[model samples]
Target: MFKFQLNAITAVKALVWTAVRRMEVKDVPTPTPQPGWVLMRVRYVGVCGSDVGGFLGKNELRRPPLIMGHEFTGVVEEVGPGVSKDLIGRLFAVNPIIGCGHCRYCRSGLKNLCLMRKIIGIDYPGAYAEYVAVPADNLYPVSDPVRGALAEPLATSMRAVRLSGAGLGDSVLVIGAGPVGALAVKLLSIGGVKDVTVIDINRNRLEWAGRWGASSTLSVTGDEALKSLRETHPEGFDAVIDAVGSEDTRGLAINAVRRGGRVIFVGLHDNEVTIPGNLIVRSEIEIKGSFSYTDEDFLKAVRVLESGLLDPREGWVDIRPLERGQETFEELAGTETKYVKVMFNPGG
Candidate 1:
């Protein structure tokens, strides 16, 4: 039998040369699956703020020339032997982190901290391309109406929610109304938390947060918002979620958390914020940092998406074409765009 082999496949890719390099798009190799791997036809990919910062070279969190996307969704195109062939043609959300299953973090079910962790778009090839080969372990199938690519960030919001210990009927002060924070508000409401408040300098984000379940949205340019917070939570907030990751937001979290309350830091701020450690010790305030989500988080995210609980089109996401990655990111870096979440539909 004469067999025909495919030569080259074209995919739009975001390539960042060392930090501060202009992103370029290029056609790359079509990946073939290895054992335990599945090939996906890239459908949608979300550009992250980290991708921008890394593009700026200020932090240079990712190595150069790698595809830059972690939040993505696709359909299984092919699977290697020993893999579940039934998964082909099924929609799936990509779990970017690859962990060793035997390590302390992995053993403890905290694979996000696995010593050998390889995050997609960071240490490994990523989904910002037409065809991506990933470990079958990293794929999660989705049913009808299928989950949008934005579900990844929704999962991240839930992760922060769990980390913050925000419970039903609890009061939460989210110190950033960005996509993740805004989604956090949605998750909080769905989780049955009462009286959710969102703070963001961006007026548009604040408005969006309100639509996403924020009981109160405040723009903290002065002390007026602080006064409002004081009146709302006379004692202090039950939980403070620092989603901005800025030094100012960190301080705000510390100040807003009630004695014995919990403060969860979910943002990736560049600088450090100084807080009264003695007061933290005296007040018994629990300050914790939430990293990325775990497998369980991904599963919960799948359930949430599958349930149609979150509708990104309902004021949470901005979808664009994959080829516009560069321009889109540049626009996002600007304060005027008023975007909460941006996802790329590569296949579109």
Candidate 2:
């Protein structure tokens, strides 16, 4: 039998940190299924904001010379021993977290907090290539191949909203209208939080959030936005979600949240943030830090996607060929485009 050779977009390290000369396409051998692993012929792989951060060397968790992609979907080409062969040719979306099942967090149903978790792409080879080998347990069969890979990000958004403590009829404010933030707004609306307000620096994104079920949108280009927010919502919102993870957005979440209300921080763009200690103490605010999705969130994400209730159509996603990964990454990281999400089609 002839061995399969495939093309992959890899992040190569450069001497200069501020250059886009890091990523390039290279031909590599197709990965094979290992024991308890399965081989997936990658179909669609979405480029996440974390991937942009990783490319820009902002995320220390992922080093260069890596194949960076985790939010992806593909067809099972081969299965290892102990795995049923009946899954061959099934389309599946991958859960990138490789958690040690016996860990305390994993055993407690908080697998995203597992101490020994190894993320695909960050810790292992990912789906930026034509083929990838994943643990069979991490794969979920998907029905819609076009948007099926969205389960990963949708799961993250779902986890954030679940942590926000927002329920039916609650007035929620989302600071950021990016992919995760937009998804959070849509999910919050579905969860029965009818009064949703989205804030973003980009008017295009604010409009996008409006279409994504946000009851209203706010354009926060500068300091004046805070004044406008206070004038409009003098009492603040029942719940606030910070999906921008910046000093400004973090402060906005703190200031825009009602006293004794909850605030969930989900964005990973910034690692460190300085907040007013006295304000938090005096107001008795409930601040929760949400990371990756738990196993339950991932399963629920799959069911939600299968339901077709939260449709992300329109200009939300831009599909490109795998070969154009470098330019697409640069485009998304550069000026604000109408495409909130970029998905790479490996087989295209």
- TM-score for each prediction? 0.89, 0.91
| Top of the candidates by TM-score | 2
Q: Can you write out model 2's per-residue Cα lDDT over 30-49, one digit (the tens) per residue? A: 66666788888888888888
TM-score of 2: 0.91
lDDT of 2 at 59: 77
Q: Report lDDT per candidate.
A: 0.77, 0.80
The stretch of ten residues in a row with the least summed lDDT in candidate 2 is 9-18
Q: Report the Cα lDDT for candidate 1.
A: 0.77
Off by over 4 Å in 1: 1-18, 58-60, 144-146, 222-228
What is residue 288's positional error in candidate 2, in angstroms? 0.6
**Candidate 1 per-residue lDDT over residues 1-348, each given as its tens digit:** 111124344433443333364666676656677788887888878777677667766444576766777888888988976898999988888888899899999999899989888887787667777777788988877763225576678778889998888787789999877778888998898778878988887888888888778888887643576678898898889999987676667877887889999999888755456777887999999999888898999888888888888676664577777667778767766665566887777666
Instruction: Quote the lDDT for 341 in model 2.
Output: 76
List runs of model 2 lying over 4 Å from the truth: 1-21
